[model samples]
Target chain A: MTSMKTPVTLDLSAAKVVTDWTHTANLLCCRVDPTGKYVVAGAIDYTVQRWEIATGKKTVLVGHQNWVRTLGFSPDGKTLYSGAYDGRLLAWEIGLETPKPVKDIPAHQGWLRGLAVSSDGQRVATCGNDKLVKVWSAADGKLIRELPGHAHVPYCLHFVPGSHELVVGDTFGNIHHWKADDAKPSRSFEVKEIFYHIGDLAPFGGIINLAFSPDGRTLTASGLHKASNALAGSRRPVAVSFDWKTGEKRPKHESMKKEIDGTMWRAVIHPTGTLIGVFEKQVGFWNAGVPDVAHLAATPSDIYDCDLHPNQLDLYTAHYDGHLRAMRIGRG
Target chain B: MQEQHYRPCGDIEHLLGRRQFMGDLLAGAGLLAGSSLLASPVGAAEVAKRGKSVVVVYLNGGISQFESWDPKSSLETGGPFKALPTTVPGIHISELLPHTAKQMHRMALVRSLNTKQDDHGLANNLVRSGRMTQSATEYPELGAVVAKGLERADFPLPGHIATMPAGVGGRGNNAAYLGPRYASVTVGAEKGGVANAKLPDGMTVTADQRRHDWRRFANSRFRDKVDSVEIDAYTQTYEQALRLIERRELFDITREPTKVQDAYGKSELGKQFLLARRLVEQEVPFVEIQPGGWDFHHNNFEFHLHYVSDFDKPFALFLEELAQRGHLDRTLVVVMTEFGRTPRINTGYGRDHYSRAWSIALAGCGIKHGAVIGKTDAKGIDVTDRQVDHRHLFHTYLQAIGINSSSEFDIAGRKFPIADPAVGPIKELLA
Candidate 1:
């Protein structure tokens, strides 16, 4: 129930495991409201839960028949959209006291792995294991257009702020960029830094998380660097940056030492220029100005996804152990 | 000399005419010496007289019981898939098997299997051979045992066949102790027909006959020089190869209509199952089809979703075809795995191998409809009632096919029990 309000300079070396909210089951994706007043998460148990930051009050929204893996909030933060493994998209009117889905669309043939609401909140985009990107009208759940060039399963998607462009990444290291009103890919590139497990003949790691730099000049794709074996979780967290205009690749950032290891599931770049990424068992922070990364937090179980507070000093993590954790990132 | 009973497909109708032509080509030069290749009875009554056959769907690596037959959807390790209700009242399985749920009435589910061996190789050997490791002797695998016990010498097709490469799961030489005659004929899963059964290009039918005569002539000369068991084995293999060549038309499953192939779903595993059904319908005695890659030590739910979805539809359709064709009463269908995955979620977000309690299913032949043989605890962690092991499963399969489980197999001057005498079949699973 503790509120993260304190403002201090960034010092991740002093960070610690702080808050644990334990009402949800094995969470997979999470997001912080635009105002940072609430945290919403999708859990494997087929429900989406929201937690009020100041009061720690929890509300569970249950309609999905299978694992709800990806979620997004409307620009105004008044509505929430969730995509589930059962191939359904549900839009919940979150401003209501007892929020229930206003519309439920059978969205895909396979599990929906990623969902994104447009900056104007007029349309929603979703990608799934069915290997198609679908856009829907936010108001009526009407299908807009289907984009189908991704040859592999897309894991995540993000809308570039203040622009109508969308970036989608797949199980392989391929990333596709599409503009509004376009059925074909506008641009595409391979982030070779994202490693795949060749021995298993399976996708080792793909783009797990992607975010645009505050100025939109750099695109950061965070995932495992080199997975000796994906099933064994023998992977190292890495974040690779690409210059948006030039498509020039930058040096990848390693979150841990060679002796230590974890898979990075989610990452976000704070407006203050701190690169925050959550690994399997640890969270890391690297100042865009400094070369070294610092440990921001540690957990007893794997963290599946994370979102930084809009205030830029606190973070929320959805865990594989069924806990929604929040950690203050400045001055301990 | 026998009445035609049933033709496997439309293409099989032309088999007898082709057989006559091939038989005439090889008849003159002692190549057919007392052996009537492709001249066996095609009578359905003769197939019935050969007793029942079995199709073993071996899943290779252990499949998770929770994700398939006995899901514990309420536990932490229950995973994301919910238990879907089946046609049989009160019976439920994972939603991953939606199609299979409709066919539950024909299935006998044994949810409590306590085979103590968890190592992949050992468990695989135990399940396939129905015995513990022996230092001095090797027991025949399930297919080999069935082949030896039920083989029709006059039939051209091999008694035991596997739609997989040889040597997987220690099965390369599964005919251990039974010698080579009852060995499984390996066929590629996706490759519809037997490999190398067709004559080399540019070799006319007459030239192929001449080559066979020349080989036999050389073999006879070599036999005169040395009397060895290896030579006898090689001679038998040569004869079998010649027989298959005469009846190679039966192996050309592509001759089946495209509609039939589509019914089988177009997956490699689906095609294998379709071929297995055809073999069993021909009364092959035993066919083993392995749809491998169930070793999900990570991302268990994700992989199981793909695996089960790929498996469920075609399997259900195959079972329906068997029932409609009347083969369900004389052919046994078995779905088995080496072990089951753990109920504990590992750090890598997957389940590890667990052997204390698992599941295997039986249907058709003498199996009882709508039967559930054993039970697992709520968390699917242990056997709560009627725990069965590999020995019990072996016995159940034998009994289902009307074979005597107590029979002895005399091999290498020793008598070995077909099934472990210490355990017996689950009587409730029997019709």
Candidate 2:
């Protein structure tokens, strides 16, 4: 057998390219609203764009003063909350003329980096440069409590579906489990080996992006080598899976080779939760639990964000070069 | 009996000959060990009664000096929001906080906190920890120190507690370097059912009671096996947890009458403040309540109105209730943020982050109410006088509660000063 230089490779033929945003639309996130009618995307242009799934036409919700880092649609799809870098959390009523400021609790003293709304949409949790994970009431925008355990900045947060627990990832490559009630974390695990350390100067590197499979059985995280030489910009990407309940990390799947070169920005579980789309300089789709090669997609430039459509199996990818592309997947 | 003396080099003979001299040097270097050893009989007696408590309301995002406590009514930087007069003569606050203005007599407004860190994490750590930004060892939060210094040995509850807004963000709210035991007990209003302040459902009353008893028994057995200060600390933690369980009602704001709840506003922030009051009244030495989401890069006016409105009513009622209960004088309430929003409105019609000059307020306890400590330029850009930094801010809080900022704690066999060595409390604000 030929020597395998890479961990995984993807087949690009199955992906059918759809509409694309030429410029000013570096999409950061896409979510099919709870109603499954409109897909909303947080973009680098500091705007939240809504795409009609049927026609693929886009409408923009403009107001945020900085890059929109994360967005979540209310359970009814009528309300949307966008967390931005300018340290503001804004709320928008679907058809309203303008997005209204509901409860603007300066969530973090630094950039408002990441946000995750609970499955029920009643609680909204946010993590950022503050290095603290805060949980709030989505209905009235009141801060209910906070989790102050992480020593470094928390990059991502997700509420475990159907459980009163939250999984939080910090910049230090540690994943902590915080019970729904207690502000203190109950369990913690570190991925020391899988994570990269630039040197004594810059250590702490693990997964920056995390996504839980719909069934909550699996967790997919994208890893990157720590940037040792910032000027050299030599960052490589890798994907790892874990047993959500036991926190047992699986080996670096062999199927994902080409996708492991650049830094992975995001990993999104498809609607079915069986397929995950990983974004780096390009897009790669992999089947859950199979460890098979990821099917790579041809893209205009480096991919910064990707998300699955609310209902269909379509994928939306955003690029650093300011382009948003829509793609549909088909069976071989 | 000759007094026992110890030197940094661990030489007993040298320590005895120069005991007084070495003692002063060690104390100055923040290497003092054990409170009993430092105090002469007279000094020890004075230390016992002089320690006071503080309640810090850390507003995570920078609160604007112009809009909050130091309104520049005549300047172009003042923007559209107007200032309203308070109960104190010649004192005014933003129209947004009319309620707080009414209770101005119990508060002292510091209009010139000139902290260096404009960044949230650094500024918060600097102000809360009261150390220079690059200081090595993580300093204990003021609350943790109070917990260590003043918490009653028999008390079964955590000495320091923190209740913040769910999505409020920032750094320095943590109990750094003090270790896990002294970390603030975080209580949320939404998750973990803020109203149901108890063990989870699976843990029945009988089961919880058994767990508590068994934990105590196990700790006792372990203590007997290894007699050390660590065992005492662990036992104290266990007892605090037990006390928390017994006085769970203190954390339950829902148990209050509907009228009382309404007075504090039914909002999460209002309820959280109510919970904080309950905690301090129940004798938690320190409580930090963080209310964030104030960074208004665009539409700063509308954002502050919507957010601060929630704070206006409940905060006033909280102060009123505290004063009514005669706890205001013993409880120090501080309202501060990391920095402030920029005075200039940007393209997005928003104000970017500004750290040059900002406003912070303190009320109750040892603070002289109805006092305004400093002034900002007409445009609200710089501190005109009485400039304060993290050290001064922290020292003022410590002095309010009667803690000496010069107090030292030993870590890794080295003496670490609690507050910044350079700055002291703002004498003007102190009672």
Candidate 3:
């Protein structure tokens, strides 16, 4: 029997490596339970797969007619909400032996690009290329309110923690802040100098993910940075953080090292207040007053979703090359 | 018994036989000589009053058949989009074209075209010129042929106008043997119309009119002193330029009402298509609107979503406009491309060039609407029935505009058939 070679030492000071569960197809979105016992990933193959973290057993959940681009889990981890390009939102009761469809709403007009569940798990919010953000009842799939402030197609959105505020980000770099209870938006912010494509005239890029600090003081929107030519998947990853209260953007932008080729798909802030972003095949962490730390060749394909473990010592990522990877980070 | 009797005007049989004899004589002599002798003043007036026009919206780069039309949802190659029911019964297209689906009754689709050339440049030339490059002769393009065949001396505008410049199809032989006069007058391919058409700053309408009068006087005096074919051609060019200057308002899209403009979405492609309709209304025989960027080698679905959605609304509005204005019977609209993308997708989730089976759509004047003329296999990889090529489509276009597909034009003393000699028009596609 042949023995495997020793692993190479990585210069990751704040964290260490963990198991990489990598065998899914082009995973677009993923959600981990609060206890980190199981993980569910929505994939380009139109199927949602739930992985048992301890045993690595896989159960495939199927219903979406197109690519499952967005996923949200209830606070209790009993219900899984998924949105797809077919403009459908399906709520799956995950506790059952075979995941059952609790409610299916023909949500948006076109591709549903964004999905969010309230912290209370009572309300679900969805946004799509139809340029409308809809809030629905998680229990009955009833409409709550329609927020239509997007001047362009929206791709990512989130609910401000500890409040009823919802911030929706679109392809045009316009961010709308809604009160969730109000019909009109409270305010809007524009990253006027930032764009996603290679040049001003090239095709537009969508905001892939947004993150908020634990204190809700900083809000960061991350995706592909502007390029000089075609958006041919060559642009680097970029993120801009804004102060929520003052609505003033941080003057300095954080981008991954030049070694990374493709754009970043998702970003999340760690419990230690470090901004960690997932790129095409790697992840990077940016801490204030320090050189940005990046890990290259972490996965084989583009990482579309990055979720922080409840313990804050582990990082889980879903990839476009069909991978669900986990990296253990600790204060060694 | 009555046919046997001789009369001053001649009996029906005698008149018919005489007309056939004259046609045969003219055919043997030459086309130009015969045209003058055969055309009568009354017949010319009728022909002018009901003249046909064609507007070709060339979706440059091979668009994916599975995403646009002929979507085979049952196959693995079908991608994510589902086929939606069009206005035509037993026919369905990609769901992305919801607006176009409603107006499918006014359009006929040809789904089985096997052009055999996958290279963009070669296929573009084949589709536009209707024949392979010839070593002995340069053949005219579809637009050039239409322009030369349907040209009216009284019409001030050029016979054919291209909203954008040509693509992939090299610029070498656009006019070919037909010469520059019959070539397309390219307008807003980029910015959406003739830029220099507007008068210079501080130039008033009165000054423009006076300058035009002086130029015409000078040209007339020069023509009297020196006359040649070259001189005549130059004078004709000068006259056409002056006419365009006088009627430049036709190129201004702002003249359209805000409601009408909004219907077309105000995109550059939409505005160019709107300008094409206006040109058709002005009696231009042919207009080609070039909306490129279908060469999606990386993110085919994303790009198609953008391009196809951009095309759907404005195109539907254009078809409706033609029908409402009672020009449907005399104006032909076509949506086509160089070829189609492959059915097998690559790792980038994109499809490359596939020429074995594809689709093109035709509508309006003399076209059988709500018709699906051909079919592709389950995987859209092969032509299962009613296979066609560029030559057959070109012939059908010629026949749709009431042009004689078999007519031979003398180019440099060499005869050139309007359509290819080997292939004939699709008789079933014609009304």
Candidate 4:
């Protein structure tokens, strides 16, 4: 995996929206192919859309019957794996002129919320409303093992960098570490700082995503805390990081005290250890080594997911306003 | 034959005195004249239709057909929920209502409803009153009409009761021309369904009874001085309140066994539904339950995930309890909303109002069991067949209880049709 030697810097005042790409249907998730030729996003219309980086030529991939909320690309960027609310997982050959689904399987009984392709692109980890974390063979969509012990609905999952183990996040903000081949978790703990639960039900503000630093030393779990009106979508975004080896929480990135009216739907850790979180209103870039946000970039609309471009200096964000914005980081 | 059932003209007092159900209640209201109360002519033919009632489970804002009763999970606009098969074969509904699905044999579904109004206020008025709002005229709500049609003169309690959470409700302006007698009394599970129907800790029942007797004497004197509709109506209501106080046990579901209470669950809506079942048992005629907070214009699925659980089990349990207790034979239960949510989900992961096509579930009474009426196309944007509206539903509701919707009511010599004449009852739904 290519790592960014230097992530976006706020001291240089370099992050800004460089271009705007529009789709009439709102987009939910985003991913950039390693080839840097296309930026693909999942739209509310139940279609994954790919837009050419240069000419803005758009292609619609229609196979899923529901919102495609999670997307991942193979290391070669030729294969795209998508999980949708319809509980179906699809494998697509994006290298073709007309991208088509090559493999489709019923991955879960209900909403398939979280998915991650392994570093070697041979396996995929997924979790859904069924409270099951499953690892599947990426080649032919075969379930390898079902990781149990999630008492609540699992929201996000990720393969540890340079390792086969997986860390899963759930509605109660609990993170469970599972060995790739084992059904039982090696360790489990709660990120209580970013989660809110009234009781056994109406649980909101849990860990929506889990991201590991390039070196795999620190793990950042992102969601909302102190939800004032969870039903009205009122909450504040927060990302809490933990020391991987010792399981000690690093007391950084927890001081986002500004009460934003949305959730930190997703977060990604850069090679430089800067955690980028897309929230309801804007994208917040936090210095992972400190307790405060380094910079905040306002998007054209509230954002759901963000991915760094293959060029590393640029970012693509899927937004709630039916548009995907490209944020260019540079000397401009 | 139907017109003979409702004689709202003179001799109402004679008919009122004849009802054995109103014996103690009417005497407490000072509505019974001396000899007439003893030798009243009761109608034996009216027994079957007299106690028939209606219960409306109002879902407050718009309920998504895609998430509740009429899901088309494979379509582009179908959203995410799977359409699980109900107890009745060939009929499927949203998986979000699994508990309701188990009891589908007792219910009928109307899937193609085009009420035509999308705004909450407009659709609420249209859905409840069965008439579009206009400055020129207004109609009584379904609850008020039901209460007026089926309220037992013998069991005299609040005819229409709205069990609701704060803000999401329907007590005021509901009666319209039906008058205050039929207006809904706002009740809650937190407090008693009939507020303060108990004697003070210090006061004895004898003392309260004496006080009631003195008040009745005074009200009788006032009636003797001025025989007016206002006075008669006031006496009737005051007596009804007294009767409610006497039978206050009806409001306290705590009197029910712990297992019974637990079956209703701990959720607030569950308790309200328990209260509704209590009212249903006592023959209160019309009960409207408003769980509210369904205006999910944001986080629709997540919110539904949290919200539907609060009511689904209780809903299924209610039907189960009614059937077990034999009240289902005389009670018409309707589960509806102001309108349906949009098939096209918005950017906020929400759905706005869409009245073009939606659904409501009906059960018991005169409804045909396991019937599924009307159909929406592949996409639920519009009704594809047998489309019905609120007017037709209103006509059906009355017809379900043996009331002829085509009959005219002599409202103070100003004739009024019971239901809109433009449309008739949904015969396919009627037993």
Candidate 5:
């Protein structure tokens, strides 16, 4: 419902917007640092770009041979981990001038689907085509434990806070809860769908670009529409909320039919729990409590990634069309 | 047993003689004999001395426990199927497996196996490998270990043969960490049968013999000219390939009697299981027959009835044939799935994946016949006692085939434990 004009330079409206280095490479996945000082984006070129939240300067982290599929920031915000289709997880130190990989762990035999960092920063969990969710020592890149029980590829991984548990959703629509310390699962819940691919999990509400909610009380997951062929319509984005304690799930909120001509690339919860941002053709937002059609701003081309500034409720939207737009959230 | 009902023929004797001749040729060639084929020395002696083999009928998707092994006859969880009594007084199986129940004198049923994985991929990996997924290294499959421990190194065909699609049930069946050379030979749907594995098209015996002679001469010259380890490895693989070609008849099921073929069912899964029997009889240590499409999340009764009937006929026939041929005591037949379907039927009239408790059946070598181990609650919701996870299953499998499950493999300089450190074999299941 909103229309915006292209700008040569970054613009801040009634809402304070921050300037950031726009990326030329299409972004596949993005994560905000725990402290909100940096934003790490995995690009289609298999390189991870780390941007300083305050200055918008970028440092590229390179190692993956295939497109980086997912990214995670350690709890300490000192280390950045990226999962790629090349079946490797690369750990990058953010403090370095040019972000470089410190450890490269070949974690899966197939494409690395998801990556997550524990609350303590000591463990990192990853899952992929191997159907096993493995936890690694962030300190040494050594394998700590493996959580098994997924029949299909584990599409997303999330570490619930305050508990030693990790939640994994697979392509088969099954969600498993694995105890982080042990190599076994504590419980599992099945969503009765054919090919449900869980795209992302945001627990609690940090900005949409951040790791799971620091509290681990709530879980928000995005589902792909193409998982089941019996559905009459095309793939669309659906958001689900769950209580981390009781394992109770709320009715899913279905957004607008995913842009078939354009892919609904990424979805993140805004720092405020009420607002969730979905990036496809343009930047769109849906309120978690309200069951309404998501509204998107018109843009020149498909959007790849977007992030909210830590200090202000501003949005930084990046497009595959090689443009970055900084826009206000509240008003014109 | 009725004398005229079924009788052992002289075919087994002829096969034994052929096996003896091959063993003599192997010895003459100075190839390592029997258990010495194992890379590890820990169980080499015991494995070499033991002549046990395993035929695993892998039900790829989760098979419903209520419909198969732990049928709650009078309960709602029992679905529409009825449980029938077997020849063994107290033992019973689903009516679909009436043939198997008649032959229950040689089988042991584990009614309660509470494995953690309900997801197909994870459950398959865990159940097959008998270990949890570790981030540091890939775990070796139980079949791979069996092949490593018990198979002859110089044997022409691979010790482990899988006659199904890879990635059928998940990560469980792959020969992980065993390397590609030791990985199971996957025979396709049509060609996996014993008959189709013969010499290539348009090749006469005389021409084949001439080719073999030339290959031997060339190999001898190369061995004398180049003493490189890589060349030796290549030569060894080539020799193995030739040997497998020579024994191609072992894969042909048409060589079997018409009654035998009819007994195992005419379905793909049935034929595959028959092929597995032939492979083991030919001394291949481990053979995995994967039959998929058992997920049955909806239309539980109809789907299971169709699939289970297809499985039951062939499975029972395989067991009966093994017993009649006097190979049952030396061959282990295991029936397993990724996990069991849920006890409660959902709105779709299908059961979901349930990991809490399930069933697995073992017959033949080292297993206690007519024994039902473990138990589930009345509704089949949870394991009432004797919980067995993948670790236990792996341990039991190795123990049945005369290998120690506590063995470890060194991967990436770390001594990774092979099975779950917490669980061991169900001793009661072993004779």
Candidate 6:
């Protein structure tokens, strides 16, 4: 592993593969532990797996009864929380020698799409098909309060780092802001670019992923766009950013390189102010301040989720090909 | 007889004179061409007793059985949804169809379907026609067959009609050897009512009436001079067209009461179901509507959530509306797809096409309500008990409407056994 103790340049174009490990099933959602020593992912086969960063040893944590869609980690890195399509939320002690379930409960009425733990580790915000955003106790998995304002099913939620404030995105492309500490609804805005319908019918793939920039100034929503024929899976990957403080949408951000057919399933902000969007066929990284053309790298399989290791150099991706991939940024 | 079948406003009555008129028309046409329609029985006595009608809802691109009728959610192959109990005890379907689940008491499910053919075109033909493809012969689809077997020969409107998306509609050639008389006319799901159904704006009502009177007189004079089959068929078509023009408003669902339209909702499938109701009210024997885009080879679960949500409510409402209107006892409503999806989830989080095991739903008419027959194995890869194929369903459909499947179709002196004569109806499914 390269040391970041000395100053090093970050170059996405020259990113190199660091570690790649296999899972028995396709991984849907993934997260890097707070300690940055382990990466955890939830799989299609109903298991939460944690891999040791150095040994590459995989530990399967089974508890979820359905396809897990989102994962959150406690600030101490001792506990891992997974939200699944079956609406069940389970917390596991990932730090234990044999990590076991710490808490489990039915969190929503339907498929739970996103889960986010506050940086303080006191509050957890989640959203699902029930068209609700809920804040819960991270300790016992009890309901704190239901923050309801979304007109459509919400797919992703994220906490503005360092604070309990939250942002949630829905199928209609509406984003809601909530003061998580008080569990009250604030302002909301809809990005029509991520939502579309023909007549009374709408196809899937909305604002599926949400992430906050390190400085909490920019919030980016990621999903497929320009669905010419949603029925036939006619869609392209895209990312849309907004000024977090003013709630104003920025110019459309999309892959300007080789044309691709699927969606930008997940977007994460790099510590260096770069916005990284992972698509089904490619991963794109661009400086958020640059405003335009992104550096894209073709992936071997459909990438569903990705997380940046605390080391700020290793980016882990969960893929549909039943593999967990790691790549080092600025290899050149 | 018309009074027995609930018409509209609860004051409906069958026009016996129209029945006699249609019979006379059939006999007159038989004299011109010696057509098989007359030799073949026109209407079933039982169907005529209540004015039987059929509505078929085709789910384009097969839906996965695991996600609907025959869920194995406990098993690894069950995907991510839970199996929800319906109105009927011991009968549970996928939670994705919560709306349809409430209407389960009025419906029967056939879970163990082994249609075998996975190709869209072939499977569609096999299920709708109830016959395996034989190179030398093509059969009329269900709508056409139902139109031929159950029609009272009374409707000025086409007995067999398929409601489609606004532009992709016209005359369908699925009637096969049954001839154009039994073929279906295509209409819009939401927008255009019927193409060319209106009189020219320049022509007043009086002018159109005069033209109609002149055409009838000219047609009678021509018939007296030349008793040609082509002329008779043409005259029959022209007259029906005139009648259809008079009732053109029926095809426009926007004209339906606001409450009624709201009940059916605004989705294309919803409006089509509403249109099916309007046609059924006018005694159109066979009405079909296709809610397409079911082929979920990729993103199956995500799309199914969208597809099922769109389908669930309107269908349940259709059943409720039919029951309230006293049509449930006579209208045979069916929801079917070509096949079921694979139990194995693919790399794309989708279920591929699998014909070994699937499902279809039937309700109303002679179908046994709340009856669930057959079962698939735990993995949902194959039928484990009482497996029924499309042929059995065809026979059952005919039997439900009081048509004897063993009867032969006298298609211009060539004998064609109705419903593939080899397999019989699922007696358990018949009330």
lDDT of 1 by residue, A1-332 (tens): 99986654776776665778886468888888886778889887788888888888999988998888888888888888999988999999876767898999999886888899888998898988789989899988999888887888888888878766789988888888999778788889797568573322356678877888878888989887766655545678888888889988877878544334677787788766778888877888877845457555677778888887777777888888888988877752
lDDT of 2: 0.66
Q: What is the DockQ of each candidate?
A: 0.31, 0.02, 0.15, 0.28, 0.01, 0.37
- What are the Cα lDDT values of the candidates? 0.77, 0.66, 0.73, 0.78, 0.65, 0.79
How does each model score on TM-score?
0.83, 0.50, 0.83, 0.79, 0.49, 0.87
Supply the DockQ value of model 3. 0.15
> Tens digits of per-residue lDDT for model 2 on B1-431?
33333213323223333433222111221221122121112123225533245677776666666667776554236754567899999988987788998999888888887776778788777777777778666677677666655645455666677786452211122445454355566555443313224445354666545544554565666676786654564454445545564666666677778888778876767877887777767767777776755665543653564567777888888889888988887788888677877776443335677878888888898778788887888888888988887788888887777766676655545565667767788887889
Candidate with top TM-score is 6
Candidates in descending DockQ order? 6, 1, 4, 3, 2, 5
Clashing pairs in 3: A24-A322, A26-A320, A26-A322, A198-A227, B164-B189, B188-B192, B188-B193
Highest DockQ scorer:
6
Look at candidate 5 and tell me the lDDT of residue B386.
81
Each model's backbone clash number:
3, 33, 7, 2, 10, 1
lDDT of 6 at B94: 89
Model 6 chain B TM at: 0.86
Q: What is the DockQ of the complex in model 6?
A: 0.37
For residue B22, model 2's alpha carbon misses the true position, in angstroms, by 46
lDDT of 3 by residue, B1-431 (tens): 11222223213323334433222211221112111111112123225434689899998887788888798864247777889999889889998899999899999999989999999888888899888654355566889778777877688887777785321111123666666556566666333255455545555666555544555565666677785444554455446655664676787777889888788775778887788888888879989888756777656776777778888888988999988998788998988799998887554566888989999888898889898988998988899999999999999998888777777766545566777899898889999
Scored against the native two-chain complex, candidate 1 gets a DockQ of 0.31
iRMSD (Å) of candidate 3?
4.1
lDDT of 1 by residue, B1-431 (tens): 33223213333223344544243322222222221122112223333347578998888788899999999966366877789999999999988898889999888799989989889898898998888765356677899777767767677777887876222211146666566666676665444355545544455666556545655666777787897665676576557757765765565556668999888876777777777777777788888887766788876776676678888998998888899999888888999898999998776678899999899877788889889878998889999999888888889888787777776765444567878888888888898
Candidate 6, residues A157-274: lDDT per residue as tens digits? 8887898788888887877777755545677877777777644666466778888887888888888788876655667888888898888788777765566677788888886777
- Model 5 shows how many backbone clashes? 10
Worst 10 residues of 6 chain A by lDDT: A197-206
| Chain B TM-score for the candidates in order | 0.85, 0.81, 0.83, 0.85, 0.80, 0.86
